[model samples]
Target: MSLNVLAVDDSRTMRDMLNLALSSAGFTAHLAEDGLHGLEVLSEIEPDVIITDINMPRMDGFGFIEALRSDDRWSRIPILVLTTESADELKAKARSAGATGWIVKPFDPAKLVKALQMVAG
Candidate 1:
């Protein structure tokens, strides 16, 4: 089965890139501008996996991860943090917040697809 993904980023360009990449790989892509928008989209779609940026306007990735993890219904969804930040502390924080995996920004589309499959499966 094809995977459904929710990609949350404040940059329209980034969202567009993700859409192109995931869609090209036979995955259904859903876009969200930020954490708040992500939550709204989340309510409508049951994504197999979620990809989020670390910094965002309404809610950052950490806050977003924590918020979703707090809900029993969404807690089990796999979340992957895709960001420019590569700080080990930040990775640790994301891990504690419930992210299933991490991908450094300027992500390779193929690798991102593989990571999504790994996490979702």
Candidate 2:
């Protein structure tokens, strides 16, 4: 079966880029403008993997993870945080919030595909 991926970011450009990349990698991509929208999308489409940015307008990545973890239905979904925040503290926080993995911004597309493969599988 093809993998289904949900990409959540406030930036339209980022969402588009992720959509393109994941599609090229042979996965179906679903885009969300922010964390709230991501959650809404999740409720409808049970994606195999989720990738999100940290800084968003309504409900940031941390809050999104908290909400995901709080719900038993969504708690097992793998989440890979892809953000510009390179701070160690932020990485730790993401880990604490239930992120399956992390990818820093300006990431290589090949590496991103590899990461997605690792998480989504």
| Model 2 lDDT tens row, 1-121 | 3689999999988887888888888889999998999999988898888999999997999999989999998899899999999899999999999999999887787898888888777
TM-score result, candidate 2 = 0.96
Residues 1-121 of candidate 1: C-alpha lDDT, one tens digit per residue: 5899999999999999999999999999999999999999999999999999999998999999999999997999999999999999999999999999999989999999999999998
Q: Where is model 2 more than 4 Å wrong at Cα?
A: none
* Count of residue pairs whose backbone atoms collide, per candidate: 0, 0
Measured on C-alpha atoms, candidate 1 has an lDDT of: 0.95
Candidate 1 wrong stretches, greater than 4 Å: none
What's the lDDT for residue 18 in model 2?
Answer: 89
Could you tell me how far off, in angstroms, the CA of residue 119 lies in candidate 1 after the best superposition?
Answer: 0.6
**Per-candidate local distance difference test:** 0.95, 0.90
